[model samples]
Target: MSAALGLLAVIVLTAATGYFVAQEFAYVAADRAALEQAAARGDASARRAAKVIGRLSFMLSGAQLGITMTTLVVGFIAKPALAGLIQPLLDAAGIPEGATGAIALAAGFVLATLIQMLLGELFPKNLALARAESLARALASSTLVYLTVAGPLIRLFDRAATRLLRTVGVEPVEELHSGATLEELGDIIGKSQSSGHLPADLSGLLDRALSFGDLTADEVMVPRPQVSTLPSTAPAADLVALIRETGHSAYPVYDGEVDDVIGVAGVREVADDALDPATPVGRIARPALLVPGSQPLYGVIERMRESGEEFACVVDEYGGLAGILTFEDVAEELVGEIADETDAREDAPTTGPDGSWLVDAGMRIDEVVRLTGLDLPEGDAYDTLGGLVMAELRRLPCPGDRLTVALDGASGHGEPDGASGHAELEVVSVARRVAEKIRIRTAAAPAPADRPEISDPPCAAPRPEEASWTR
Candidate 1:
């Protein structure tokens, strides 16, 4: 009976080893599953299961150590008892009596090692990993009970281990430092959305809102050329007429060119003002808010929110007016396009056939670049078509000066039109230059036959000055 009891103890110890080994690694999968389930339905069972797995992990760790120690102690203390039981088996195999004890001891060690490694460690670990969620739930209460019993011992060992680890200059693991990346979080959110755990519209909105962070100010800002304004010295009646005609709430009050602008005037301020046809436009204008062309859209948004100002004049580095950005322009960034009743349909920039674009005179140069794959330099100097033309001309350009310009189709992956495979624009007519505002006519061909292929020409080289601006 003693021998039988000793055999049973070995079997129990082997099983304990396997269970502990499995419980340690299985908890991670169980915890993840529980979190996913919780996100969907707030599953109490899953939560309990996750708690159980955690406790089981702790208990299993202790049990693994305890079982090995207990096996060693028992092998030493009960050797004679175990050897006597093995003696009969050895006799049946025709082994000598003297060799029995040695053989029995060797066999005992081998058996313990095998049971601990195979059953205790590998087998249970695999099971837990494979069916982590279900197994964790089933064993949670039992695992918790075991942990409760071994809590003091576990804490003592844990404290000792922690101290030893610190002595060896090893810090405890910081799970947060190993947390998910943005892509991983995005994936999680996407998966949640796909699984119907979140509302589709809300998820889509969040995704779009997050995506808006990627856009630069240049991509979203109102280009300088599209800005409409009134002269600072214009008659109050004329200013009111301009306001009435344009239907814009605010207008920049410039003295000569837009670059020499003084201030801005809101229609709302004029709405209540008494009819004073002779009042100078500059006198009624508010302080102008100016920003560099290169300012970030997000920073601009923040500044606008804090400043309480509705209008900002975009300027180049040379202190010339490039364009203007308004509160309405920034609003379009967050919520797509905004069209009103007063907006001219024919004057709007429209997509043309064969990968070309027909931009309106009032369209922002920045918007043109975004829509038609045009590459323009960024600085405080030029922010619009008019500003760009003025900067390139150096001197004021006249109507007759025909200049050859290259459109950067390579950057935007735009296909060339009929004349040539290269994407380039030829200035046909210098339409008008009212102060800083300059309008030029462009030829809608792929590229001139004389123009070199984009591939043959070094892309790194600066764009050639196709035509000089003439007076």
Candidate 2:
């Protein structure tokens, strides 16, 4: 009976070890998937599943270690009894008595390893992967109990491991439970949406939320041309009148052109100060925080949070004013378009006939690229369509000038017709001679070819820049 109990103990230890291993690995996979889904705009279910799996994973790790240690101790303690039980079998098989103990020990160890590796580790892990949500939910409570019981021991082990790792010139693995990165979370959300585990709108909202990290101040800022400002020389009464007419909370104060902006004035301050009517706008203005157009929106948000500033002036590399970015701009990127009580303008500056829109002349190129699905090149030098056009052309183009824009294939090759797709840029229009503004018109070109092929131009001269701004 003692021998039988020893054998039973070994079996239980092996099984527990396997179970913990499988649980740990499976939870890792599930957590990774969940994080990706969250980033991709996945539904709450995926995120919840991920969270449960992550918590359970740590518990599983502790359980595995405990079970392994316990198994070693128990097996060592039971070795003599287990060996005695196997002696009879070895004798019956005509094995030497001297070798019986060694044979029995080897056989028992092999059996335990096999059972742990297969039944405990592999099978449970496969099951968990197949139905992660269900498995995670079911295992959560038990795992928590294990974690609570083993917390102190786990911490001690972790600290030791960390020190050992540092001694070996390796960084300690950060505790795995922190959470998933934005991109990884996005992928999981995308998968959930594809699997019909989440609703479309909610998934889309989540994706947009993740995108807030990638957005920049330039992409969301109100362009310089679109900003309403008070001249520094303007009287306080005139500044107040302009603010009332525009219904804006704040206005940039400029000495000359908008590019020469000195600071920002808040309507509330104007009301509170009740400054003399002849007071210079600069006298009422507050110092402005200036940010580069290339600054990421996330960084801008952090800056706003740390500085307690509400407005930032975006500028180009030339130190010229580019636009104005507000806290609301960053907020809108995370939560979608936010129209406030004071935003009375019905028509945006750059609407198209089919509802496809042009970014305002002053709008940041990054924002246009995000909203319009345009593939703009990356660089710090330019942040608007006008700037991009000017860079590419090298010279200011006349109304009838034509230029070719190339679209690289998927493999980044100039394939006009091949498996990848055609590469070509057709001239749509050019700058209006008098106004110095380019009026681009859209025209249907042949579908991109898989291999290189050039189509003949129908027009003798490039189409003239259209006079109307609407299209």
TM-score of each: 0.51, 0.54
Counting only residues 3 or more apart in sequence or on different chains, how many pairs clash (N, Cα, C under 3 Å) in candidate 1?
A: 11
lDDT of 2 at 374: 40
- Global fold similarity of model 2 (TM-score): 0.54
lDDT of 2 by residue, 342-386 (tens): 764344445356433433333354444444434445456665655
Output the number of the TM-score-best candidate: 2
Error of 1 at 467 (Å): 26
User: lDDT scores for all predictions?
Assistant: 0.60, 0.62
lDDT of 1 by residue, 1-471 (tens): 477777677677666656655555556556564454674587766676655543444555565566666556545534554665777899899998889889987776666566656776678878988987777666666667777787888778777777888999997542223257656766776778768897866665555465566555555555565677778887777778887888888888898877798998868557756758778888888888877767877777777678888788777679888777877777765554577887644344444444444333234454445445455343466545645544554544443223345544432313323423223332223333422222233345533333223245322322222222211
Candidate 1: lDDT over CA atoms? Answer: 0.60
